[model samples]
Target: MMKEQWVKDLSTIVNPQDVKIDEPLKNYTMTKLGGNADVFVMPSTEEAASEVVKYAHLHKVPIFLLGNGSNMVIRDGGIRGIVLNLSKLDQIRIDGTTVYAQSGALIIDVSKAAAAKSLTGLEFSCGIPGSIGGAMAMNAGAYGGEIKDVIVSCKVLTPTGDILELSKEQLELGYRKSIIAKNGYYVLSSVFELQKGDQETIDATITDLTFKRQSKQPLEYPSAGSVFKRPPGNFAGKLIQDSGLQGKGVGDAEVSTKHAGFIINKGNATASDYIDTIHMVQRVVKETFDIDLETEVKIVGEDLPTDKNKTL
Candidate 1:
């Protein structure tokens, strides 16, 4: 399967407009960083998405499923193979007290939809920046609630392009982790069971939570949310703050002055700057608290190429 043949087949199967070559990743991610993607595809339907996956599997081309690009950081050197943007798969439906959302649907949108229907469980997600698929992959949570609490089941596309419906237990969701991510499964959609509630109460809750998030987080800058997972029995932000690493940075990537947990792109920051700042935070936190702060945000791709003629 040559690159040209694969692209041709994919274009024929799906719409030609949806298939793009050497697409810049900066336009897709929240951080507004990253280099170009060798190939980028947006599937308007599940059938189209499935076809793309099947072709990628058959060709042995690495397939990367991108959600809203909220919690990810691609390298300056860019990604190899195909980058599948699920943004076109956005769909939302309600049956009884359960809400079914496609992978590409924003979590906040889902929460708002639930609130409109007077559903009670998803108010916490109103401020979450990632898509539903990304949320399910990481069991995204905030304000004392998480995806695991509301999720009943999910539809996933396996690495072999086979679709499977998995129960909550099968997902094995944990603190910012799930079996889908562990097993390289792509989330297609999910069913969430919710309780009946007053619409006013739900809307109020969402508004309050949104305000809290805006006040605390560095929303003015580009960032991948909380950069480090909470260390056991302690918060990562507290650890970084205690280490005197707040407002510190490497290049343009700074430990957010508003929230030490976040590594923000102040202005014109490169992927290397972000990576360097992350490493610095980890080193200082480890030295100060004897705790190795593990990253919550996903970093992918190769490093930027340097000029061979330059000397150190």
Candidate 2:
């Protein structure tokens, strides 16, 4: 079947308005610099999301699940096949001390909701820019706390279209990694277990953390936060800074002068430029300190025709 036919069929299964053809990924990602996706689907409910996954699998089309796009970089050539977005599926409910959130629910929203309900454990996520699904997939952490510490369990849709509930132990979460990412599983929703705390304290903590993030991160530019994972016995930002890689640029992509860990898109940057800058930083850092820098941001799609076979 042709790509257009596939998109049309998907539109029939989902809402016509929810399906977009040749959708520009730049509008969806934080970097604001990617090409068009052949098909973009936003499912408003779990059933609709599951159906889209099943149909795409049966049709032998590639499927990519997009969260808030806070921690990802899509190539300038864009994505082929279907891009499944759960952005419209956002839903959050608080039951006692537990927070039930849909995959599309923003991490910040969840944190705010938790605080309003006097829940404490989620205060650490107040500044995270991604969705619950993306946070769970990477066991995202900040301010000395992580998702795994509060996540009781999560509902996931398998690649084969089966929905399964997984316990925290089953997630196998490590630093900036999780079993869901390793096994190619899609998170449908998550139930976080938090504690009752004083509302004043929670609010103050959130406020303090937000201020710290603004002071340390380069919020004025477009870029994925914290490009590299912290290497063992060392921090990625400290390593880059020590290597004198701050303010380095290739094209419009520059190593942030304020934060060495971030590679900011100064303006009109291509994926190749972003990636090349990353490589250069890595090479220099490794050669100078003998510490191999591993990326935390998920880089996807084809940047160049010749890079189709290259692994991110």
Candidate 3:
């Protein structure tokens, strides 16, 4: 729980105007179905973000580092103490063949910027919609290319507020995970080394990928992207389709008929509905194929309190 004093304290770390009390999380998330955040702190700089973390660490306050909410699901109870975001820090720079991007910058925008400069390696990520920080933490990839392939290094803040520059080898990126996630570090910025390439070829690749993604995915509705990870020797979408879960759902959340890999929120869906749909798919897949379906989405925040409000 966030106390009144904590709110005032956070204002000292950043601009008081940016410190919001009981802010609705639904406005920030892609699902549009979460409870209010107790205290939302949008810091403007890396130093300010570090100060807030250090304060939280010393005071034992529960804190959450919020992203742009493309790959996450926030529960109805919302977040407890402080929720920190670095949206104001968004900046992307291209110097020759290397790219420098702040943590809050959109990765899609970064990819496009790189392509504009005739950089080739980032074309694969042109369609990935996520913050640079989130992408770095997850080693975001698409179309047979991943962030780990071109990442040179990143500046990250440790859980205790110490800053460290991590090399790609130290990042330990593997299969939708990285050291940043394991150590709970907050990424400030990252540098990627790209190569000069033909401008026409890069643009063509992005166009083709964008088309394939739009045609195959359930882009009409809101979703947390692919719900489950690719299991060894098999794909999650194929397995879910084989299990006959498409279009089946709980409340307003349904397994997308267009793509079995995604669970879509068909307007007015609650987080509970979305989560239940995920469990339902997992249960069905397990029973049908005897293989566990590991979730790729990051499910967080608190469930609604048990009372009359509870509904299936």
Candidate 4:
């Protein structure tokens, strides 16, 4: 199908206002970097979302799901085909000690909601920056807690646009991995099992975690949180710091001096620069400690085409 015809059909099913052509994805990313999306679609309802999923499948068009734009970096050439963002579907509901959150709702917000009801078990997630979908996809963890501990079940869309409610056991969650990530399933919403706890205690824990995260992480600049995953029995930041790689990177990107785990966008940095900086850190860390650093952040999209006329 032609781009114009498919996009028009897409707009007809979902709201036209929710559809965009050649939309710059940089504005949606946490790092404020990325190229344009061929066709950006934000469906406010599950019905519309499913329709879009089927549409893409029927048309044999490529589809990519975007959550809150955390923990990912899109290259400069942008994404082709349909880029689905569920930001408009954000909704959170609380019933007793159970928290139900849509994929687009921020995990941090759900943590706050749980706290407001004097619930526990999610205190460790108060500072997690990704959406619920992303959290589920990655089995996101912080401090001493992980998503697998509290997740009861979740609604997900299969690659063929079929919806299923899966239990925690079915999720097959592992360290920074899940069945959803493994199979490319699209998250819709999730139910979490929390416990009633002392309001004062919950508040205190959140405060302490928030303070530590703020004081230690370079949150002022645009970054995709930690650039590399923690190696077994070792820390990525310690390795980068020990390698003397702090405060150095490619072009406008830099390995944050305040937090070596972060690669910050020092204004107008391209995705290529950020990726190269990550490679540099990996190479140095491997050379110094013989440890192969693996990236935690997901990198996607394509590189900008080089101009033949430009002199190297």
Strongest candidate by TM-score: 4
Give the higher-lDDT candidate: 2 or 3. Answer: 3
| CA-RMSD of model 3 | 1.4
Give the root-mean-square deviation of each candidate in angstroms: 1.3, 3.0, 1.4, 0.8
Q: Against the unseen true structure, what C-alpha lDDT does each candidate score?
A: 0.91, 0.91, 0.92, 0.94
Candidate 3 per-residue lDDT over residues 1-312, each given as its tens digit = 346788899888899999999998988887777888889999999999999999989998888888888889999999988888877889999999999999999999999999999999998898887899999999999999999999999999988888999999999999999999999999999999999999999999999999999999998898899889899999999999999999999999999999999999999899999999999999999999998999988999999888986677
Give the alpha carbon lDDT tens digit for every residue of 82-181 in model 2. 9999988789999999999999999999999999999999988999999999999999999999998999999999997789899999999988889999
TM-score against truth, every candidate: 0.97, 0.96, 0.97, 0.99
User: Which candidate, 2 or 4, would have the higher lDDT against the true structure?
Assistant: 4
Tell me model 4's lDDT, rounded to 2 decimals: 0.94
Off by over 4 Å in 4: none
Candidate with top lDDT is 4
Q: Which ten residues in a row have the lowest lDDT in candidate 3?
A: 1-10
Give the better candidate number (2 or 4) by TM-score. Answer: 4
- Candidate 1 per-residue lDDT, tens place, 200-252, comes to 88888988999999999999999988988888899999999989988899899
Model 2, global lDDT: 0.91
